[model samples]
Target: MGYGELIIRSYDAQNDRGRVEDFERRCEVGPAKRVFLFTDTLGDPMCRIRNSPIYKMLVAELDSQLVGVIQGSIKLVTVHKPPNDLAKVGYILGLRVAPLYRRRRIGLSLVIKLEEWFIANDVDYGYMATEKDNEASVKLFVDKLGYAKFQTPTILVNPVGHRRFRISPNVELAKLKIEEAESIYRKFMSSAQFFPIDIGNILRNKLSLGTWAAYPRGESWGEVPSSWAMLSVWNSGELFKLRLGNAPFSCLMYTKGSRFIQKLLPCFKLPGIPDFFHPFGFYFIYGVYGKGPLSGKLVRTLCRFVHNMASSKSKDCKVIVTEVGGSDTSRLHIPHWKLLSCPEDLWCIKALKNEERENLHELTKTPPSRALFVDPRDV
Candidate 1:
């Protein structure tokens, strides 16, 4: 059966769980030659967007078999016009089609239905992210759907090992209360692009491990240092797991060799690679902000702290991940492995309302800000 028999309907967790899970397992993502990634939503397909205040998921069924799925959520976010000027934006994620369903237009039908829902909810703009190298996805949204490329962000990833990172002794790290964290972020980062108006809800989310600030030892939270930095962690590891497929031989050899060496020389304490062959989880770092000449160094220290913190967790967190605008200055200090990171993650957007087309066009042409506020719930 083809598009004629395709039916787009709301996703039901009770009835669609098995079919959806099986479909996701068969749809491996990334380049075929090198390692590919599979995201397991831990049986809850809506885990990514369930935290949002408004969200929906739709699935396509062909010949009585589930063939495709897409999820979208709406939220008010800061636009380029003014810090106070907010727009209701809808985010699309977890778009997938069964391997055999490719070229049948089932994917298109699912996205169209989701966009219809976004329009009904009064979304000003709709957007989604994918790897720059994903040619098929790029063509589908930009070429087919008439969406324009809006932003190119980088996905920074750093492996977590047994070794602890060393931060400068001059700096001190302190945990901040939820209100304190909210105050700091709003006071300094409110002007940032895409800054979520519901940031407090995110910080208060059960999955949010906590927020922290790094400044001089003698300094107090009351007195903000010019070189200070702040960050928050989301326990995404609890929401889902990631697995690497088709790994190169060299990577396997290095991981195995490092483990063998560590066993032989306990004193060596070499940082061995995590078990990639099996499914593993990761911690997501978001709300990265800094200032002053020493701010870069402080940001680096904060990233290392996150690395060490993830390593200490009882769960199997193999990596620390975050996304930042391509031109974001703080990215220069964030620790990430090039081999595991994506340099150019493409984001495309379309105006759901015809009247908002001009605003969307202006956004696409505007230069990226130095800092971008990545909402952890989007991941």
Candidate 2:
């Protein structure tokens, strides 16, 4: 029978061990051979999808034969600060086909099933990621599936190496116990676009190597002060930094009320934003908005404080990377630093829905571009 006659279905946990073993055997000739081929012990490749308010899965099948699988999850994408409206978007990951089924429409059929799944879940847009050099996969996503390149996935590298960060006298850095830090993080995230990075999960899952936070000393007591930064070290000792600041008051004034105008406008008033606030300005950097003085002096102080902390933490790490879109202000500052190729590449598509198409214009006010960052493992 033709491969087109094969079937694709939601991953069956009962049969996953066998399926994974089969996949391993099929991909033995390519780069996939280098990595261990074991099904995630977590069992649900769609675990993230299940947690998502909007998630979907599909399998391609012809008669009773399994041919391929597709999975997607929904989330928001922001060019800047927290509280950005969450959009109905889908991410396509874990697309696989058995080697024997090559050059068949099974993969395409699987994606079509995913598209239907997205429509049912109210998702108007979809995106996925792939290695830059994966020609066949790229062609399939772009040429065959009609997916467009939204951003170039990049890996940024910091050849400077990792060293212990020292806090600037003007700024104070503290290593909050995980429990205490998570408490503060949860409270502060209510107004921000912060994702809950469970410290406990990090510890238990061995996802985190270490974590720390930095803020102006006197500002720590109430509301957990939005004007601080956090750094989490992953298993590879790679550093991920998040800086918090106020949203663009001017943009707010142009659209919303002026209540936060006083707080968010000052950063723009400064001769230049601090290095720390520039999202794409450096490797291993990320940011959120909070209330703060936007003066050059204040910016410099904050940047110094953050720099001290990051520099010190680099001691154990070999490389750092951050993702940024083309039109983000952070991109403007990136020219000031050194960078290298990133392994995590992005694959994005335009909105397929009319309302969402209009929303895209609003959300993505800036031009689209790809970002690169160096994976620590390669360093």
Candidate 3:
């Protein structure tokens, strides 16, 4: 039988030890960056998906050889059509196919099964992200699948240890408890893309260090502040290192042109190669929003304090980052890596239903999710 007859099934933890190695190998050769592979560091590939309350992981096997895998979550997404409208949606990520098993419809099969999962969960919409330059991935989602090119969002990365941030003395960084943070998020940032309605659960997660708010010092407790900004720190230590020389990519390619045989046994490994993934954990600053003229100042203070907190926690955690759609005006607030950044990556999506809803215009249309919010967990 052809590879098309491969058996597709939910992840099998006890019987899939070798597949984890194969999965990581595929990722090493695949377009997705290795630094983002948190599963590798976690030891068990299925831990995160199995542990998450809303996620599912799937794998493809051909005669007992694992060839492909995919996973997703049923999410309640917030949109900007009517501004702050909510929709039940699904997100597909961690798509991987073994290098030797490409071009046999395995990927399409995995996604088709995932779509079934989406419908089963009662979600009518599905989406996933890919780099703008990755033609293979873009083609798979857009051409093979019926997904439309949705919103393109800029990813802003900040290095915490590079320099000390100078938060204004007048601005106080009040670290709010989970209850306070959720209450504040509900009031101000409800319109953001994927703004968690269950924000309390997110804040209380073990990975979340805490959440903070920026406001004028000595301000009285009120329903809301005139000039304010809010952000939460998430620990990404589980994603370990993928350095230049040590990474599988470096071994498979040469810095200069070489014969085909040389490519096969390339020992490209060498000392002094820089590590792409952070040694210290990464702190993702998300749910950032501001209002009024003083909002800019409030935002800066929050970033600085977040940096300070990360620094004090340990020497290893240094990078901080966030993503907002290109059309979102809120991007003007945070200090990001000006020289180093991904311009805007596309979020490809499709609806599981036959009928199109009016409130989901931004999500289903061509221009797509202009002011959408990108949760750190989604990354």
Candidate 4:
């Protein structure tokens, strides 16, 4: 078969139908197994490239036949606040190429093209993620492209059958009616970081099992209003939830997503979280706000509530996952939360721009510190 001509261009909605079909075909291969396809029908690609912030559609034309395609997006890093020196960061997501086109550097070319796009758009930082088990793709990013491992968010797996989790003492945890939860959410919106949990979105999340809150009886950690956690049960046989205000223990419950920000504001921003990291199958354990000793207790209480809820939801779902900054002080306090052996790696590149380089130098006096990028889901 002849090697294809690769072309990278702006997305055209009219051409997407063919692209979607091509994408579906590629998904039959093992490399695309993890890609969540969203369809108007069953199993459509969840990632609508047309709706993405900055998207690229790469098509490889072999002689005249379209043999391969790769799609990706660049979005602002919204979860973690950037250091002053590196305020503008964009992330690359949903990268895939046809299996037949593998080993020909098509994937690398797609990434390089996206990097070029990032540089041109004045985005000085870029990052991407892949599962640790994906050795081929990992090699492509690390060896071929010169991207380094910046962060590694661990992925913890627990069998769905093992349903053993308990709530903490000295704190009262209970489920709140949906209306009550929404009211509390609205009241907290003023102080929340990512406010206004799309009520519609919440309703659409059929998996949202319930919401829980924790209240401290005494003056433990300066006015701890009852902490809240929301549970989402996925059809994939996974139970997920988020805990607000409690650190350490609580961070393990939810995946980092927009809902997390709305639930917790004034919380410490973990570095190197890309926006594309969806909180699927993972539980968010803390509210987005407040940095104090009280955060840990609040997280614990919320975790207890979520654990109880998970047991009630189903006997199938077990194990909780959350992400925290390597520097998060609360993480230091938790000695029993088993750390995963291999962490998800975040690979980033400084978009080579003369002006930005000068500004970065003036601010940091050194190259900005690199991070071990972790996918929000893995965290």
Q: For each candidate, how many residue pairs have backbone atoms clashing (under 3 Å)?
A: 0, 39, 3, 40
CA lDDT of each prediction against the hidden true structure: 0.86, 0.47, 0.69, 0.44
**Which portions of model 4 miss their true places by more than 4 Å?**
9-42, 46-71, 75-86, 131-135, 146-148, 157-164, 173-215, 219-301, 310-319, 327-341, 358-379
lDDT: which candidate is best? 1
Worst 10 residues of 1 by lDDT: 78-87
TM-scores of the candidates are: 0.96, 0.54, 0.82, 0.55
lDDT (10s digit) by residue, model 4, range 234-314: 233332221112224333333354336534652544221212122223333322222344556655555544555555664
Candidate 3: global Cα-lDDT?
A: 0.69
Off-target runs (Cα >4 Å) in candidate 3 are: 1-4, 29-39, 47-51, 80-84, 221-224, 239-280, 357-371
What is the alpha-carbon RMSD of candidate 4 to the true structure?
Answer: 12.1
Model 1: per-residue Cα lDDT over 61-170, one tens digit each? 87788888999999998877533468899999988888777887777888889999999999988999988888889988999998899889889999898878997898
Model 2 Cα displacement at 319 (Å)? Answer: 8.0
Give lDDT: candidate 4, residue 351. Answer: 35
| Candidate 1 residue pairs in clash (backbone atoms < 3 Å) | none
Q: Candidate 2: lDDT over CA atoms?
A: 0.47
TM match of model 2 to true structure: 0.54
lDDT of 3 by residue, 223-333 (tens): 566677777877765544222223466533432223343345446422121124433456777777777678877877788787777767756665677777777666776
Measured with C-alpha atoms, the lDDT of residue 99 in candidate 4 is 60
